[model samples]
Target: MSDLSRTPLYDLHVELGAKMVPFAGYEMPVQYKLGVMKEHLHTRDKAGLFDVSHMGQVIVTGTDYAAAAAALETLIPVNIAGLGENRQRYGLFTTPEGGISDDLMLTNRGDHVFLVVNAACKEADIAHLKTLEPAVTVTPITDRALIALQGPASEEVLAALDPKAADMAFMDVATLTLDGAECWVSRSGYTGEDGYEISVPEAAAEALARKLLAHDAVEPIGLGARDSLRLEAGLCLYGHDIDTETTPAEAALSWAIQTVRRIGGAREGGFPGDETILAQLETGAGKTRVGLRPEGRAPMREGVPLFAAEEGGDPIGQITSGGFGPSVEGPVAMGYLPTELTAEGTTVFGELRGRRVPVTVTALPFVPARFKRKPAKVQQA
Candidate 1:
């Protein structure tokens, strides 16, 4: 812990009585005084503030926006060139074999592209982005802190500070001033709720966090609760649910790939492993990621081997992410199963403590998402 890097809000977390732990090479709070369960429920009902500065933030620029977008499209399997201004899209970096290198969020910020990538893979991701160097300039933003305010009450909480926040739709990015500091905000989050992810200057990060916490609906949430919330939402954790060996098609993330990058589309086959991925799109993969519900009270944690029958058979697949979903009030998990066994309601068995336990395949997102996809309607005067 002594050598681990700390975020700008590390001291604030200590003051709030957080249990600090090492995560992604950083000493971060895993839970506060309220604990994981309470913190998890609080975020679903109200708002929770998360210090996510450990993630990488980078800006890619070129002669113009199109040049930068085109350079980026060569690596990611997304239609970056068609991304609208102030809008964001989820994308992935694919390997030559069609496996996912990393998943990220990219925003088309007028003059340049803003990217937020996984914390643990930032170094490699940055190095990978440098390949687009001659065509685009890669600038790593190290002087900023990233924070997320997430929950059903997030909109009202942020709107109280700046009314303009209420007008932004889901996935919309904007530059807003809060507490007299310039902040880049995006109307999105990982908790399956309406929220905002803000990137603010290092000097102003603590002040902004404190201000947001002062609100009655906002609480200081830690990594433990963050994990549970995202698991319940059926979202993938970079290293767990997705990794270098997993292809986007097998991970059930084909939705993130726009048609333009697929076969028979105008701008197809430009990214790495385009042939492999495009073929997967036309012909499904052998195994696919699916939501799992372990029967009864016990949780089927990660790495648990999956079996097709209760006795005398080799493992079929393995659980990638699992936990007690606070919002769902039961144990939930996600893993890769054979495409033949991926149908909804199909039954499978998890080898829990050497005994096969009944588990059922189900649709993802144990809890429904509550994103504010559209702006609130206004009444005529």
Candidate 2:
């Protein structure tokens, strides 16, 4: 194991026979003895507990939290002023040219703001936030550990510990005491299911993780299954599905940009990419993200060439994230292409193994989302 960047659960993961790999400068578990396929299926059927400590946990504090939040929103696209205490919102940071800096989660702590950003872009995110709000105290909670309890059974697991935790609705965060350690629990997940992401102190995180695992419905899940689960949920992965070169519109992420915060009306805080993104909002983006299903069992990989699927079809797009979707029972991929080629029934080409593979463009998530909504609305792919 490398000593460079290790999670609080590093020792536990090693003891479980996980195949460790380097991801975003941190030594993490990609898979375990159960393998990716089993882990993926297990998460779907039961609950998967993941140690996501590598993700950056940042806290911004000031007497005037609202003003400071508005300032931070200047660097990202979101309705920060709309956030109530202990509420969380999934958002993104954008560049001046409208490209995405990274996807993140912003939470209101009543007096402080807590942010969870991608590990790969955490350093840059900190730098950018400092550039925007120099007077606001910004501190990276590097000594914290995060764990995601994902699946339909998460309610039961949490209810066993604290019934109050089960009452928190999606996108809401609440402070809870776990074995004398304070933890920030949020009713949010990446697996298109009802779950919670817990941020606990590094010292007590391992103990809490073990306690969560002791539950019958919860099992240790490696990063391999986490990737597949998020893919099925139609979530974006930094450095792959999204990058500094990719804009929010092209990434099918305009929803992250609050409409009220656009330039036309008297918007709140003016972020870096406000003008460019507002333009894209008014006028459609030329290129957009699309999902693809290959004709056969061959899985698509990132950086694979894309074509128009004609006799002399030229390269038109590239796959960002792709693989065998366990739930779909077929090969599926997501990438960006010309807006004209993003139609659901449109056919495209994914060049694989020196041959062009027939592909059909489909809507995102590729699989129906099982997220719990008040009206039980299921967003079909």
Candidate 3:
């Protein structure tokens, strides 16, 4: 703890018997006394509270909406200009070579754009955004602490705190007062469950956490369960599933680029890696990210090289993310492979502990997502 930074709730975590570990230069809780497996199950069954203050939250503002959107669009491939008020969109920061610099969430708040970037890449992200300079102002919200409440019961627990939270749909964001704290609540989470991410003032974070934890449906969760939950949902884990060398096309995240940002669309593509990314979009990439399901219960850990069906041939790719899915009740993993071998049911093998373990190309989101999308409003007669 000498050099590692800690969140506002660090002392509360210690009081709860949290096992702290070094992650992204912060002393974060990886698991509680209940262990990772149980915490994973609890999140699926009830609700789990997570301290995500290590993530970066910033407000990007300018004199006008177009200027702010265009400034941000220059770095990412998303259609920032077309994002509706209070709507959230996912985008990737691409390098000039078309590789990913980082992944982020962008929310259009009418007057300004709100960004949430991965903790490990936050500093670099800020520096990169600062290149916009006088065109747009990038202000980091250091006084806030972010928390994620996820699971089926998350809505109920949050609704009890602020009934307005129940009206929000997936990716919807609003300013709400929860337990007397003015928080920025979003109906979005890394887990594939219905939930909310609340950003509150640092001083109010502990009291808010304690209030939620006291609820019968909520339990404290750590980074361990958070990783497993996101993995099961097929979500990328920044440095692992994506990195400076992996482009959006290779990472199976092309959908993050809206139609307006694609070739021949309104905005057309003026992003960092538009040329390379657009070319890959049209011609397809050499290796595509895919889900892998092992034939046995053996977990196919990351860095395990994957081989094609034929006995003797060059290795196509390697597993980027792998772990046992508590919901799937088996081993699940993801890796990249050639376009021809990306078809579902394509057989592939991985060398684990000096043995060739068989696996098959499978679709992602081993567990189904339960996001709450608002029903379409009926037109008045």
Candidate 4:
């Protein structure tokens, strides 16, 4: 752990009695005194603050917004040019063979594009973005810390500091001042709840976190709870559920590719592996990612082999991400399965401890999302 880097809030996390562990080359808190289960449920019911500064933040600039968007479109399969100002979109970097190199979020921040990539893949992703250089200037932002305030109570918690936060809709990005610190905030999060991901200057990060935590509704959540919350929401963890070998189509992420980038659209097929991905869009892939629920109390963890029959058959697929979903109150998992076996309610068997356990294919998001898509109506005085 000595070689691992630490986030700006590392000391605060220690003071809060967090169990620190190594994650993505950083020493991060996995759980606080409340533990994983309580922390997870608290986030779902109230608000939880997460220190996510380990992720990469980069700004892409060009002669103008159009030039930058065009340069970015060449790298990712998303409708960047059509992205509205102060709005963000989820995108993926695809390999020449149509496999996903990484998944990322890009915001159209007026003059330049702001990107947040996975922590473990940031180095590689940054190097990849440099190819768009000359056309677009790639500037990696390092003097900032990222934090996420997530859950049903997140809006009210943040609105207490700045009333303007109440007006922002989901996927909307804005520059707000919290505790006199200039913060870039996005009305989005991984927990499938109404929340905000804020990027603030390193010097002000700790103060902002402390201020947010002072709220009765906000608690310090760690990585352990973060993983479980995302799992219940059926969100993909970069390295586990998606990676270089998995194509967006196979990962059930086709929704991220807007229709404008599809075949026959005005700007169709410009990104890497466009041909392969476009063809998959027309014709489905061999395997598709699906939600799984183990029949018994036990969890069918990641790398567990899946089979078509109860016994005596070779593995059909493997679980990619699995855990006890606190919100769902059951063991939930996600994995790839043959397209034929991907129908809802289809039965599959997972090899667990040398015994085959029954599992069912189900719709994703064990817990329904609670995002605030529209602004709240103001009450008359």
Error of 4 at 280 (Å): 0.5
State how far residue 368 of model 3 sits from its true place (Å): 0.7
- Candidate 1 regions exceeding 4 Å error are 375-381
Encode model 1's per-residue lDDT on 157-261: one tens digit a residue. 888888888999899999998877899999998888889999999999999999999999999999999999999999999989998888899999999999888
Query: Each prediction's Cα lDDT score?
Result: 0.94, 0.85, 0.92, 0.94
Model 2 lDDT tens row, 1-381: 455699999999988888999988899999988899988887888888998999999998766788778777778778887888888999888888888888999999888889999999999899888875666888899778999998888888877877877778888898888767888999898888788999999999888988988998888888888988888878899999998898888899888777668765556338777777788877989999888888899899889888986457678999999889888888888888999989998998888888888899987877666655445678899
Q: Model 1 misses residue 66 by how many Å?
A: 0.3
lDDT of 3 by residue, 21-57 (tens): 9999999999999999999999999999999999999
Cα deviation in Å at residue 242, candidate 4? 0.8
Tens-digit lDDT track of model 4 for 235-323: 99998999888888899999999999999988998999999999999899999999999998898889999999997879999999998
List the candidates' TM-scores in order: 0.98, 0.95, 0.98, 0.98
| Worst window of 10 by summed lDDT in candidate 4 | 367-376
Which of the two candidates, 1 or 2, achieves a greater lDDT against the reference?
1
